[model samples]
Target chain A: MTDELVLRLLARLHGHAGWLAVAALLHPVIVLRSPMRRARGAAWASTLLVSAVAGLGAGLYPSYRALLKQAIFQQNPTVGWWFERKEHLAVGAVTFAWIGLLCHLAAARADSTSQKRLAALAHRAYAAAFFLALSVATIGTIAAANRSF
Target chain B: MTARSALTAASAFAIVPLAYAAQRCVEVGLGGELDPALVPPSPRIALFWRVGVSLVLAAGSTGPFYRLAERSPALALRVAEALAALAFGLLVAQAVFAP
Candidate 1:
């Protein structure tokens, strides 16, 4: 029963992953082109949703480990700290990425300069989010590795 | 900067806390769970930080800068540039003082 449950969960996760990958590929092209841009906008939204799911999946493992470390050892706090901070950063990154993709898609479909500006803003926001996440993750990883565990 | 441009800026500032907040290490007692026990239950400081962060994020979400991004490539580029700078700063800080 346990094995069956695990398999079902894994299968669901894989399905979601496939969707996210497709959306990720489709979104950027939609940003540049027309007509298809509307369809792509929907895809972008879906992709962001999948990204959030994937991120949570990725986070769970580290979080679980952190919980174990805190519970058993109770001596070091580095890994646990890293886990939490990384999750927050990941959330921010995805939010920005979605916003950017949405803006870009809308701008591509738009005919006005003002609409284009919105697209650009979204791109900037996404980039900022990505970098912010990268920094936090990198630092946390290093800190955890060097920590007195 | 127009409304959308302003939102972008707000969003950037809102995210800045993520960098600094991650760096903060509050010494606390582990409770074998996600919640750690801080030595002192000082709600004021915690409240202040949460409020400040909420303001930043709220500004980004509610401001006009995001809307402006749809139209102005220049504004978008400018905001992107600023965020890039922030990202760089955050990376350096994390790398240098992470431990």
Candidate 2:
């Protein structure tokens, strides 16, 4: 496929991933506030959702890097900078999401107080991850709009 | 602070600038120009803002990690810290030394 076609495909994939991340962010709050059993379900759902998104991102990284290199050489430094920051933050978000998932699993096995603490931690991590995803989405949008092909 | 919490906090603190620097490495290594608008007029000032903002964000981002350390098994916290530190180190090395 031509480079332009590949970039277009990646852009669409990024858009879908961005929306999926936004939806996943809502689950953490529900998990934190819901009753224990329901919260567990929410946590599981969010974990799977975020994991899928992260996986998609990982798959796309190589293409994204190539396009970024192209942009850099083309003198669209703004797009390059935005994309670099977005990818780094997205990786960080994924890290937090995994930690949150681990915390959720621990909560499932723990006593009430311990469960609460773990759940709280999981909530915070998920929230952070969500925001990071949003930042990535925003930056990506800006980059796409302003980038010179 | 418990050893676990301290370690988590430290990892969080360290990862931010490391990540930022690593990204810089990717840009510079790739021969990408830094956005002039984002770069301060002075190199020292630019570095200060970059490091300062990264540190603050990194510390704040670790709230969950700290909480996790408080309640999770010690092994879990240790593993997380080690992974984060290793990733950050590699990224920094890639940024600074990668051709």
Q: Which has the greatest DockQ?
A: 1
After best superposition, candidate 1 residue B79: deviation in angstroms?
A: 3.9
Instruction: Name the TM-score of candidate 1.
Output: 0.46
Model 2: per-residue lDDT, tens digit, B1-99?
A: 344554465447446645566555655767855444444322233333544566677777687767776666555445554655455455435533533
lDDT of 2 by residue, A16-104 (tens): 76777767777775556542633656656666676676666666655554444454535676566566566666665665665566565
lDDT assessment of candidate 1: 0.46
- For A1-149, candidate 1 gives per-residue lDDT tens digits of 67446644653563455345444534443443442233445436544664665455453343334334344224445554554455444444554555555555555544475455555555455554446445444544454444322
What 10-residue stretch in candidate 1 chain B is worst by lDDT?
Answer: B25-34
Name model 2 segments beyond 4 Å from true: A1-7, A34-37, A72-74, B1-99
Q: What digit string (tens of lDDT, one per residue) describes model 1 on residues B13-81?
A: 435444333333221122212343233222233323543564465565544556646666466545554
Q: Tell me the TM-score of each prediction against the true structure.
A: 0.46, 0.58
